[model samples]
Target: MSGAHGRRERPPAPEPLPAPTVDAHTHLDACGCEDAADVVAAMDRAAAVGVTRAVTIADDLAAARWAVQAAHWDERVTAAVALHPTRTAAVPEEWFAEIERLAGDPRVVAVGETGLDYYWDHSPPAAQQEWFRRHIDLAKRIGKPLMIHDRDAHEDVLRILREEGPPETVVFHCFSGDAAMARECAAAGYVLSFAGPVTFRNARDLQEAAVVVPEEQLLVETDAPFLTPHPHRGRANEPYCLPWTVRGLAALRGVTDERLATSARRNAERIFGLADVPPAAHPWTGGTDGARSA
Candidate 1:
């Protein structure tokens, strides 16, 4: 379906990967999934292309609730819960408690999609930093990874992490750093999850950074319903499009798709612990009617 503004149509599903891997970060809610049925269908589509699992992220309260529920709806889906930095600029203090409680759920593997975003002033730097620190502490307390959303504020993000003494596991989602920043992140033993932009012709800096990342600290994602890979750049994205990214990243580093995909899967399993868990639920049948469970 095309949007009234002439938005590109959804991209066709890429070929199945030579090996299965996981999309380290994505927003199922933002993808327009509203319930169990929606979650099931999405995972099925991903699994068909060897993208066996996904870590759905929530950037707000409504999304947090749905993401958690989505994780349960399909065994293939896990979740991360947090308020986005932009959304944190001015929120009630009580909201953080609820996020914390949700973050504690066993199904929630990370606390983030949160960090600094100087690109948009939807939130002030001060407020975003305050919430970012709280999330940093929350991840430390819960002992889960911290998935960051650093935009134009890389230095501040790094400084704050250093100041607060970041949690044991830190991940920079859709990392936008150059080789220097990538080296800093890698040297600090942080994980760098790359998305579609690394494949773009003008993304030389990101591509350079991609080359420097160690295998263990490397991860891949679609960040889908957004950032569709090359050949599908302007199209709507989904987890099914992950292999395109895996293939793109592999070529950028001068490696075969299978080699990169294997490492990515291993790293994802190590970080998110979502290794080859077979789906327990059937696919969604809800375009127009009845739904089914596992």
Candidate 2:
């Protein structure tokens, strides 16, 4: 019924808490939801299941701004800003300045979700290469890590990163390559972030990749609202379900869930520049002298 000024009043509720699991990477700007309310609801659902910190990424200028704002809404959320490789053609030259400006913000931690995607080829190869190099330059200049999105173009991506864009910390998110490639990436000092695909029955190669990657170089992510792990297959994935992926990795690596989880957390914090994380509170610091439990 209409109340004062003919308006319907809403009931009060308690403030929502953050998730427990740490979602290493997610595309908050591309969640395909309507408005900020939808985004918060999605985050709440993730938190309910134990997912905690999330690194929400933005693939372009507008999305970058939205990501920054979203991070402001929750202390548990951080942001990564850069142009997606596929959208390189759409990114104007002047937008680089805006990216640079955003990259300087404290909330913006990494400089990507940018790299090569030969599978789709949404943007011209040359243009993608140029933009990718520019992003690397900016990351290097600002001393931030680079979050790479390489899909079916591993060789090219590796070559470019090795030649012109050697970021201090390079993270290959949703890594789908094989064991050899994983070894090479690890040897190159790049962090390999595994997603739900690693738990797929048919993803033996990806499983192998997870096994060979050293604990220090391994990180786990949901890539959520997408890439839901096995049992939850075909469903809209959320960060809260990362434990499934972590469990899968644990099995493949011959380590306990707590052990793998701790290592992954430490690796994420190290690569993501989350040094402010307290030593005792860090999951990997539970036992021993900085060595992760196997």
Candidate 3:
């Protein structure tokens, strides 16, 4: 939990924005919320700052199941499920079937946090690409958006997405590409979901990339418990800190705080198909009965 300067805690919440928005991607589990009550408290903090809803994503099967229950427990949360690229190897075969089954649940909104991660050599590039294609196909089959995590493998990610044919709604989570790459993604109609990295002073290229994404193709996320934006970088992050990233993005895109929030919310609704209606609840109380019934 420790970050730069040996700090292990989050900073005070920034000033609230004037209108509500959705954190397109976040990881409530990594934030260490122990149970439904704990998750709701985190949501309350975020809602207080105009971040009224969030899509909690999973990096592996175990987390995906938790994400599904978390989403059903609260209307303000949605879930995205997928195996992280680095952790793809060593997973049991049933895990893939489980993920495919979970994808059918209305509470599970997207298939993601999936894609290549060349930054780490944990998984071979071939395995990552193979799993990425599987997830992409799954997203297409389920008719849900595809949330990608492309770290240091932009070209390969884009190439595979093209080769497999991207889903109707494709989102690049924590988009770290330059303006040219952003334009390439935009041309292919991919949504660029910016995270805390866009707020760093040295991320000028990323900032410029943010400016070119059409309002409808733009999104903002906390990617909570990591990438805690500028001025508070390295502090443990939670959804309440989204406003820092939102405001920073607004400054880059030359829009008012309310305008950016409004557009981001609209984009989230359109892509995720929420449109103000939460998915039907499929609550699981940690037993075979709930899982079986669902």
lDDT of 2 by residue, 194-251 (tens): 9999999999898998999988888888886578787777665656667788788889
Models 1 onward score TM values of 0.92, 0.83, 0.93
Q: Kindly report which residue pairs in candidate 1 clash with one another.
A: none
Number of clashing residue pairs in every model?
Answer: 0, 9, 0
Off by over 4 Å in 1: 1-8, 275-294
Off by over 4 Å in 3: 1-7, 276-294
Q: Over the full model, what C-alpha lDDT does candidate 2 score relative to the true structure?
A: 0.75
C-alpha root-mean-square deviation, each candidate: 3.5, 10.6, 3.7
Per-residue lDDT of candidate 1, residues 1-294 (tens digit): 113212336777889999988999987766766667777777889999999989999888878877777776777888899999989867887888889998887778899879999999899999999999999999999889999999999999999999999899999999999999999999998999999999888899999999999888999999977888898898778888899889999988899999998899889888875553344333334553322221
Per-candidate local distance difference test: 0.85, 0.75, 0.87
Model 1 compared with the native: what TM-score?
0.92
lDDT of 3 by residue, 67-98 (tens): 88888877888999999999886768799999
| TM-score ranking, best first | 3, 1, 2
Q: Which ten residues in a row have the lowest lDDT in candidate 2?
A: 1-10
| Alpha carbon lDDT at 103, candidate 2 | 84
